[model samples]
Target: MYENTVPFKIHSDYTPTGDQPQAIEGLIEGLNAGMRGQTLLGVTGSGKTFTMANIIEKTQRPTLVIAPNKTLAAQLAAEFKAFFPENAVEFFVSYYDYYQPEAYIASTDTYIEKDCDINDEIDRMRHSATSALLERRDVIVVASVSCIYGLGDPSDYKDLMINLRQGMICSRDAVIRKLIDLQYVRNDFEITRGAFRVKGDTLDIFPPSSEELLTRVTFFGDEIEKITEVHYISGKVMWNRNYAVIFPASHYATTKEKLDRALVTIEEELEERLAELREQGKLIEAYRLEQKTRYDLEMLSETGFVKGIENYSRHLTRRKPGEPPYTLMDFMPDDYLLMIDESHVTVPQIGAMYN
Candidate 1:
């Protein structure tokens, strides 16, 4: 059994009533006894979320509450945040407000390119969720089924983090280059998420995980001097820190070396697939595949990404065939608790996800 170093402190006005205390005790006991799957079996208005919160408090483990839809996920996140005001309560769902995936219809001889419109606020929340998991132990993430989708390797994300400390000797130009490599853009006029601006001796950054706060780093010549958090709108310094850690701007972050290796493997796979298609007398299929792959390869070589880039995630992550892609679950600590809300519906939905 893992020891709980961080205690779960639920800040609420009301205590557990009716069967809630009993239910909480039962759940906690089951969890302590290594019960893998146990249902709460509560009806409407049974204070299910309250009981779960109590259980979390008793268990003292980071928890993930998966809701069936975005609406429910938002509601759960709000409730959890209210319960654990001082702890980390984050919401995570698909950032895309609208997404039409790429499609190819052989019978109709038609192809449709992928299109998506991302919600900036939701993207920020997703980043906050991931960052909280990595930085804290008292975290509760309320999420939708999008949690099962592909995310960058947790190790790679940690490896790419930039740590800035006061008195550390570092060049300003080097810092800017590192941020650029992590997908942060330089915008002097507009301060926004994933963007940074540089003045004579100070660098202002709007980190992806933050919504209204900006990080100000003052450099003295080639050495770091100070780091401060400032209000973006009011331009008031909230606090000062000697050090800070900045994560990548995007979830798909990778190193240049990985990209180079992936490009080579992609080419080899394309050639091997083309040869098989030709041997099977599928000339038209082979020609179409060759043309599309070559175009994507050219785009990737030029820009480091192509349309439908996620299709090559396996190669980029260097995973073998049939290996499951890393998901949000991978970001959680090993002893974290996973609570599937409305399991009657959620269970089938999770099962159907693979199909």
Candidate 2:
């Protein structure tokens, strides 16, 4: 029966031999025995990834492969892309080419601030990974440490999505507001990802951090009458989505009302911090904090913007202290299959991240 047969066809010239067969068999046996996790202990250049892929083909379950670094993740992603030419093979890594997290050195009394430069290519890959996972049963995501970082709750992310059906009565202004609520900015001048341009009743959206098709939202006077997908590089419409639900362009997707509440909370925190500083005879720090926060509040109030906004993400999320931060993993379904490429290395890192 097809159910008992391997769902994939192996096209490689070489076949599994030596310890590879043994490793694959052991892993499969462990999985069948209700072992939720198994490690493939093999040396470098042992073709461990290949063995993992073979197991996946035999099981025919969707998989995720987590790697150690960007270089390794990229190599694994490329390999999976080649192996599963017909499947949704994706890559996820840090979107920042360089990042320095904010730190406070109380001894020297220094606040090392968070700084980062976004890598568009990596950001696009991250988007591709989540999008592919939601759309298909066969997907492989080779990722780095970025996967464990804080992100928007997937439930909220999915909830914010707006499905635009063909001939649906979607108001132009309503669609624009939805896009904004999803953290997509309206930039009539700049035509970049996560930004939309309005040409009369027509809207063109270059999805934030995506490697897929550019979505076009065209309206007929007030209603979103048609939605089409176009090639980002070629500027060609490939297909029309009977319906399209746009996800938040960024991790921070807060409504205006929410932002107002956040501002209020921030103000309260600022006052509390100021009082603490003053009590400790940190007059300089108190003044510095007051100035910085006042400037930030002004910026937030004026243009609805502030620098290094993610530093306050914990407060913005409104989660209890010590609770785990949300991440891309939350975007995955409950039954989503996961495969760690270098399980011996990856499994440990997964546990280490929580601490």
Candidate 3:
């Protein structure tokens, strides 16, 4: 496991003024006294954000700030990143730029499949947010309602991480296999995100955790020689590191063993569902469900993935029916602080996550 002991220190030029200091102190006191929640009300120009930062510093706990929308989340993320530049400040919102939900109209007998355009950078940052929660302390994730939605199982995601250290004994073939298991693609020609390449004895791993740095694992015969961080664009050796960790390329990462088990469970569920539909004399529905499921199963067996895989997350993550899906909140420690921006609006949005 990764370790981070740094306190939540703020680097703001302006100190708390007016009621800001009082509010910060009260919040910290409440937290220390085991209060469940406390509200901080402030008007415009009151510097509420700064007050929250101070509270976080005094409490010295990681925090998750939820906003009602993406724009507010982004703005808050930028501000917190500036305030705690030494810590891990991450942004996490929905990747979809524009999303139209899949729908069916029985009157018109129309089926409209969902369509979306994902912002790659946002998706990468989402991965970074979850990774930071698992690998580091002093983290602040400013997210939108998308965070309350289903996310990958935290246990499985953490288990998929690959830890490496300089001078460790490991074979090249074994390293490559581990990378593949972490969903890293092998691209010998071009270097990009979540890709690995071999140049002689050096294995350049383009980890998805960082957008700017690439991990260079140079092997001397059967033993590990060195580990260094390289700039992705300039190809300059930034610095040498004693240890390195590679997070999964995709958040929904799983081992082939789990995948095999999930496939069997999914197939059994499909049979049961189809039988229920047939008993209700819904032959067309049963046939449609079978067709879709079989096609997905075939894709999973052949390519290890299928579109809309999250729809089967219960089986994929080995959760029982009616069990609550894991969300980004699950990645954070239980004692982590939570701040809801514009709670009057954001609270309702969070409450409607399952509705």
Candidate 4:
């Protein structure tokens, strides 16, 4: 529904001054000359973000600005949102408010399982970021080092999306199935984010990327008769449209065939690993790995997902061994811009994550 193309225009009361003008011009010139990387050295309060915004507007290319941490990323995203009010300015960071990595201590013979609590709001914002990238070019995503981490395949995400247009030949039952396949819950009693409800010929869908509106589609027999945005609570129509697009409820979008293929590959990889472990005479470790892998496989077969399915992302997306995982940057076009904030610090942080 929100695939309208537009130019980025900064709605700011302040104007560029000091080195700001030179920095902006130099950056634009470098981009025009096909420079892959360019830095704008500036101290605190030097309006570097504003300068970057100007560069983005001039270049007219989608930009991803990475900060070293979530706080800084949030600040940059807010400023960018203020500047480009009409465009998509998304904040993306690790959704976990608290995270503890899984570990095993040989000395103490202790196994500390992985544990973390994800912030729902942050998760929603992350979905918003990916959705914006897929739908439009006028997007500015301010992300932390977590941006380097795997975010699933964007092609699969865009391909599996539910695109409903008025007068299309789609049955209400088919729409329900599409939502469920996209991981949307059917909450008939109350409409919540990532949920859908049906009543008679109308279907209400609350997309994960949308915060304030739900899409209401009316069906006349097997044809989509109406599509519109409605307030989530009041159910008042906000906007009428001839088209609507519903992204996956989560990033890891896979069809049944793809999942089955991934499962087989995962089993093969597990066997290979187990052979090495057995050859090394690590029998206890080998048994533990086999048991765990089988348990995960069973869960995936029944529920279509597991808690740490991302660990087997290579299998799921069918990528080569040691290949860099698909990150948020992969969602953007090859010509899209990357602006690293506080490069001296953030650059090293990115390296740490990569390592």
Instruction: Give TM per candidate.
Output: 0.92, 0.84, 0.93, 0.93
Residues 161-246, candidate 1: write the lDDT tens digits. Answer: 89899999998999998897787889998889998999999999899999899999999999999999999879899989988888
Candidate 4 residues 1-355, lDDT tens each? 3367699999999999988888888878888898988878878988888888898888888899999998899899889999999998998899998889877664555667778898888888999989888888898889999999997888888888988899999999998988877878899898878899999999999988788899999999999999999999888999999998889987886777888999999999999999999999877777778877899999878767787778878988989999988999988877889999999999999898799
For residues 53-146, what per-residue lDDT tens digits would candidate 3 score against the true structure?
Answer: 8888888788999999998999999889889988999999999888887775645556677688878788889988998888777899999998
Q: Where in model 4 is the C-alpha error above 4 Å?
A: 103-113, 279-281
Order of candidate numbers by TM-score, starting with the best: 3, 4, 1, 2
Model 2 segments more than 4 A misplaced: 1-22, 100-114, 232-234, 255-261, 297-305, 343-354
Q: Is candidate 3 or candidate 4 better by TM-score?
A: 3
Which lDDT value does model 2 have at 28?
85
Judged by whole-model lDDT over C-alpha atoms, candidate 2 comes out at 0.74
The Cα error of candidate 1 at residue 135, in Å, is 0.5
- Global lDDT of each model? 0.87, 0.74, 0.86, 0.88
**Residue 122 lDDT (model 2):** 74
In the order shown, the candidates' Cα RMSDs to the true structure are 2.9, 4.4, 2.0, 2.2
Ranking by lDDT: 4, 1, 3, 2
Best by lDDT: 4
After superposition, candidate 1 runs with Cα above 4 Å error: 1-7, 105-110, 277-288, 298-303
Among all windows of 10 consecutive residues in model 2, the one with the lowest summed lDDT is 1-10
